[model samples]
Target: MNGTPIRLRELAPDGGGQLSKAEQIAQLRAQLAELDGGAAQEQIGGEGVVPLGGELANVLPNGGLPRRQVTQVSDTPSLIVEILRQVTEAGGYVGVVGWPELSYAELSAQALRRTVAVPEPGLDAVHAAGVLAEGLDVVVLHARSEIQFTPAQARPLLARVRAGGAAMLCVNVAVPSPALRMSADIARFHGIGRGRGCIAGIDLEVSAHAKGWKRPPALLTLGSATGGVTRLKAVPS
Candidate 1:
């Protein structure tokens, strides 16, 4: 709580000393937010929103990712990559914890470099996120299916996220409250030559919901040719 940044090394794995370490990091983030007068929370665009870009933007009530809040995402690798790419391309720093399965091949070189990744945080996933949130714009925590996300564990991390002015993306993790809950599935694949040619693109059915509102499901495409995301036109019903 001395207003000093918590280094990655200071993180303690879950054990007798885990809770105290988590608390320390949380306090540091709170102090940092206070020192900055919550400037990050007061960002101008859409009242501190992080634009996800393209048609995906329209899917959110705020037209983008909510800053200083938590959003739960399904364990869809492509969709997660898209979110990270957009955030980093927009000049936001990102931290990813406990997602060793995520592929960065689609991410731009610059974006990949700007990301701080902890493939395995053991039992300190939340603590690692808090430390990274102190300076990163977004912290993604991939909760292992075996590990439960209890409210006791989530409250402090959620507080750290708000105080640090960073967005938290929980994959396969359930916390008490989240600004948005999102999930996506592959609708179909394009350009397959009877199992002869490689897949060229995929159509994704994305759903986003919030406390008081929900956007109509969206169809998006990730094409190998363009290696980018775009809103796919809905076919006439």
Candidate 2:
């Protein structure tokens, strides 16, 4: 995808000469497969894994997020930001779709520069994500409440992710056979002892479940103390 240009076309039908929504999506996937040049089927070991940082590495089975797979995140905005930031910092391109609430300012300058954002794709969120995954290292898609995809609708999109060797992070959408499932909850706040000072850091209880295996919960700290960065630590069992 280095020399190839990414042009996003409208999903609407253009008079009598236009392709239907389904046809347009099919065309996008076909184009992606051609642009992929069979790279997705090639296995290069570590090169295929996105750097999930040391702390996160400890919890994941692959020691990082694996390319050509879809991972589901349970709508943890901060965690999502951290994941995208890490991917971008590693010189990978990222696409964010349907997350109009996500603030780009929260991302590092480097991440912000490398990210492609599609804040609101209306009902075409899934279609937009598939197209972005064709060329990006990672794509974060926020599932729309009104649009629930059946298994039939997900297969082609997931195929696109695999065909391009890109990871898809689905927020609050349960797709079939996700490689990993992660959820985060705020456990407590630090540096606010007795309510005497502003919150300097936050402790989050994060869990990772891979297929039939479930790892012990991990503790992640995020806030001003760490310069608003995420620091993950495995809590002792």
Candidate 3:
């Protein structure tokens, strides 16, 4: 995906149309829970896993994204680090496919567990997701699944994540196209409220068919997954 340009002609029948401003706001709120680091975060099974940082947790669905298969957080490696931290907890076999340097020797070892690091960090994302979907507890989908795949091709991959109950994090160079990335569960990014060097007040937008039929756009301030959670606005769907 480095040289290849991402196209979003399939986002809607007309073209890559933007989500209604109102709808975007609704989705953002739906994905996020509370703001600030002042919140109690309990893993699904009551394990106290050390988080990457306070900033990243607030951006997720439950103050942090869960490992239940195919949960993709669309952002950069900094954001992905926060997600990887959660995946290494108990009941979570973490696999960072297609992000070799960022996943293995480059990451803070304390933040990860027995990671199955993949070479060629950019190209292997989708392939690694396939292998880890059922065998692992969580998979960070750093590949651009939304760009190269048809909905039909992506369905099975997403389904495997669902069936396997694994979490996914997609590291995108650009905003994702809606047509290529739809699923039963989603935690969306609304926009950034305010920020400094690393700390930020980010507005996260989201909607999930499973969490609740009520998928509305809303807002929340997100912190850092590593130390610098570069906040950005949502790409118009």
Candidate 4:
């Protein structure tokens, strides 16, 4: 991802008339397809992958998060922050929507400078994400509880991500379909003190499986104070 921003041109309706939401989505999809030379498949390898850092990189088929695709993060929300941290730390811009609770102070100054945040993303969350995807290396979206999208509502957003060569990190929301899915089977905090002991770290058993991969689960230990993740040795089966 270059430091330069890519701005998406908004399409206007015919005859100066307004377009319905569905129609607008369709138009966006068409524009995106045209931008990619009407071949979405070509975008599969167009942009370089973003490294997840540590052993987590090994979980994905590409050894990193693939641009131009939606990757779902379920069960362990912290993983989302971890990803954003990695991307920003690497000089990649990131945009986050509908996640006001996130602790931005934990992020490094360099990373924070490259990150954009939308505290209250409303009904146009998908639209906002599509716009952000135009330039950012990664866009993290937290679907609002009241927002339920039909297949039609999602297809265009996915297409936009592909065309723009940006990765979408969906939190608690399903895309049309995800190219890769990461789930945590277990997450526990350790180092509890009797009176004033602080949380030492967290232990997670995360599994990564794509459309046709058959890899084993990955064990991770995350330190709360340092924001560091360590891959534990796999136990014998």
Report, for every candidate in turn, its global Cα lDDT versus the true structure. Answer: 0.70, 0.70, 0.40, 0.65
Question: Candidate 1: how large is its RMSD?
Answer: 6.3
lDDT of 2 by residue, 137-166 (tens): 788888656345678978887887887657
Q: Which residue runs does candidate 4 get wrong by more than 4 Å?
A: 1-46, 146-148, 193-196, 224-237
Assess candidate 4 and give its TM-score to the true structure: 0.73
lDDT for model 4, please: 0.65
Colliding residue pairs in candidate 2: none
Task: Please give the TM-score that candidate 1 achieves against the real structure.
Answer: 0.77
Residue 140 Cα positional deviation in candidate 2, in Å, after optimal superposition: 0.8
**Which of 2 and 3 is the better model by lDDT?**
2
Off by over 4 Å in 3: 1-58, 89-91, 101-112, 121-125, 144-148, 173-237
Ranking by TM-score: 1, 2, 4, 3
**lDDT, candidate 4, at 21:** 55
Question: Residue 219 CA error for candidate 2 (Å)?
Answer: 1.5
Please give, for residues 56-98, the per-residue lDDT of candidate 4 as tens digits: 6666777777787888877355667677777777667677766
Q: What are the RMSD figures for all models against the true structure?
A: 6.3, 5.8, 15.7, 7.7
Model 2, runs deviating above 4 Å: 1-47, 144-148, 227-229
The count of backbone overlaps in candidate 4 is 0
